[model samples]
Target: MILSIGCSEPLTTREKGAVYGTLGGAGLGAIIGSATGNAGAGAGIGAAVGLLGGALIGDQMQQRQNQDAAVQRQLSTQQAEIERQQRELEQLRRQQAR
Candidate 1:
């Protein structure tokens, strides 16, 4: 019996962070606002602030990850080229030795 599993893409770190931040902020705000007799207003304000902060942090992290990946790819390509050149040099040396 063979089984195939399909996987769906997960949310990016930025999206996840933003969602968490918004929820957390709203909850906190509501609690604080309730103490002041205005829970709804507190939650709204908290959610907005949380969402903005979370999104910014997430975006920065994502950008950094992308840059790191790019650098890794470049390093890998350079290594491959170096290997190829070494092989070619060895081949040339062998020919000259003969």
Candidate 2:
């Protein structure tokens, strides 16, 4: 199953995080539950909690990436505008000198 995921198209950050969380949580939960005699329940609860936590973290990270991209784009636009203004200013200066 994990192999298939790796071979297939890359998953979004959220999905990758959730998968890692669920796998890690379930393994840990099972070990703990086995010592306490409730492995099944423990694994289920752990997986759910892990999924939620991982999803939230992944979502926040994704949002940050999007914001960064937007900022980069805005910066690029501002730079172009600045360059354009500089060119116009030079043109005006040359006209005044003439």
Candidate 3:
């Protein structure tokens, strides 16, 4: 049985961006296409363009997020090492005082 915990974002940034772009493009396209008596065509073209643009933007964002995560992981490891060294130093100080 698979249970989903609400620990993750429902959609990836790229997917979210794509969805938004598609909706916005379709709306705008429909408006313009209606004026030109070719709403369907306009919407199709708009959706395609929007999808491409959104995907690119989302991919960049994802890359940035990945980089940030890597940095965070590195920082965490460093912090743990520092903590361990501090504990070891405390132990040494106790021995020296005895």
**Which candidate achieves the best TM-score against the true structure?**
3
As a whole number from 0 to 100, the lDDT of residue 86 in candidate 2 is 100
C-alpha lDDT of all candidate models, in order: 0.86, 0.84, 0.82
Pairs of residues clashing in candidate 2: none
Q: Write the per-residue lDDT of candidate 3 for residues 1-98, one digit (tens) a residue.
A: 01124436477777767767777787788888999999999898888888778778888888899999999999999999999999999999999999
Backbone clash count for every predicted candidate, in the order shown: 0, 0, 0
Ten consecutive residues with minimal summed lDDT in candidate 2?
1-10
Which is better, 2 or 3, measured by lDDT?
A: 2
Q: What is the lDDT of candidate 1?
A: 0.86
Instruction: State in Å the error of residue 78, model 2.
Output: 0.9
Residue 44 Cα positional deviation in candidate 2, in Å, after optimal superposition:
2.5
Stretches off by above 4 angstroms in model 3 are 1-9
Better of 1 and 3 by lDDT: 1
Candidate 1 lDDT tens digits, 23-75: 88999999999999999999999999989888888889899999999999999
> Which segments of candidate 1 are over 4 A away from where they belong?
1-8
lDDT of 3 at 95: 100
TM for candidate 3 is 0.84
